[model samples]
Target: MAAKRPVDRPRPTLLIILAAALTLLTLQFRGLQPLDAFQQGVRDIVEPVRSLSDRLTDPVQTAWNGVFGFEALRLENERLEVELARMRGNALTSEADTELLNRLLSEVDIAYSDFDAVVVRILGQPPGNFSSHMIEVDKGTDDGIEEGMAVVTGAGLVGRLEQVDRSRSLVQLATHPDFRVGVRLVTSQDEGLAKGTGTEGILRIESGVRLDAQVDNDEVLVTSGGRSLFPGDIPVGKVLDPDSDADYRRSIIIGLAADLENLSFLKVVLPAEKPEGMR
Candidate 1:
């Protein structure tokens, strides 16, 4: 037996409701006050929920997108951190250079001391435990610096020029054990051979002046020009309180005038020109 298919049924209720809705929309457009008021009320009630949904969904959508871009954000932050560090380092270096320039030749009276000088900067110390009493400089024969030239700072004498190159020179500091300078007492006029004790920043009169010489505490010592390596009247150091020996001699320690440990700028003394005939 062949089975017949069930007939599809259409109800008039849905059709009637749709026709009513259409009639209401047409009347609303044609100055239907009640329907307009009803639509207004419906919009007012739904608007808050719609706005709340938009607010909530926006952040969630943004967070979902951000999860995929987290590595890019982290990399960007690291790059910013490096840039900030480099800027900070440059600021500190600028401040340090400003302070170093304050210690320039203008701070001292080199012209009053009879030195024909050229300004230079200290490069570094020689690399050895034994060579701690030397400093390398940025000028040499090319800059008219010669061996045995006096090296000085604004405060006072630093050392003498040692090894000379075309563009660089080594300064043998006054603190070296073999260093020697003829110095005279500013008050008593006593002259002596001043030698480094290998002690840090200290020198002593090894000989030349008698043990009974009138040396006083805090007395100023200056260079003696006759046959001396350095010119006369350059301030060398101040005598500390002399240590009295029972019989041998007074142990005198001189505090160096220049701060050798933190040198920055320096001057090399050129030889004085002979007076018209000795040249």
Candidate 2:
């Protein structure tokens, strides 16, 4: 009664070993049917516990999602806003361009005497050190734009077509060093050669007057009829400074009337026919 028997302990251990061996043999032969049934029973018991665990952790998972997802959402919103602003700017520019083209085409078709005109878009810009006066247009001999053709904008005279290719033309602005046009000063009633200085807004006038000649600033200058390229009586520039020494050959500086830097559209005026007079 006081001592436990060794046979009892051995019997329990043998029974446990026999049970484990039988379970393994059954799994190997019959594909674990009994074990699957036992696992299903265990799942039924643990389902409530798993549900409780998920409920306890729901707020933490939600907060983690908000922290990570908010960054991507904010970046997407910023990109959309920037795209909207860019499209709006493009729309406004398109409207302004349409209005300008309508006005220029109508005015040129009616006012010009015997010359046909072709509108051209500026493709490339000249170097900045070249006074930003000259530009390249997208039209050339293919569009009937040839060398020595006059280029003008809605505001005033822009330049002259210098070199022409099959599809492109180089425009030498009124400020080019090689540019010379006959101009008449309105205020002084003085006629002189308006020549370019290769600098922005600068033109030089070589007056052929005598030592008694005198002129003031802010004089309105217009193109003379003697020029072969540009039209006659077109507004060109305004006088800025007169020569200090009037006794010598006086060279007056003039400022161009047009903004050559921001030329988007221009028209090339074809050569006009000579009128039948005194021939």
lDDT of 1 at 244: 46
In the range 1-279, model 1's lDDT, one tens digit per residue, is: 956556633457678888998999899779787875575466446645645865688788679769986897789789879978997879988677445433322243223256788898876664467577888777766677777877887667778897666566689888888788888776667788888777777898867666777777767677776798777667778888555452576567888877786567898876676335322
Off by over 4 Å in 2: 1-116, 126-133, 209-211, 274-279
The sequence of per-residue lDDT tens digits that candidate 2 reaches over residues 167-229 is 566798888888888777655556788788988878898854334456666655666656445
Model 2 lDDT at residue 150: 77
Clashing pairs in 2: none
Worst 10-residue lDDT window, candidate 1: 101-110
Report how far residue 73 has shifted in candidate 2, in Å.
28
Candidate 2 similarity to native, TM-score: 0.52
lDDT of each: 0.72, 0.70
User: Could you tell me every candidate's TM-score relative to the true structure?
Assistant: 0.56, 0.52
Error of 1 at 104 (Å): 25
Q: So what's the TM-score on candidate 1?
A: 0.56
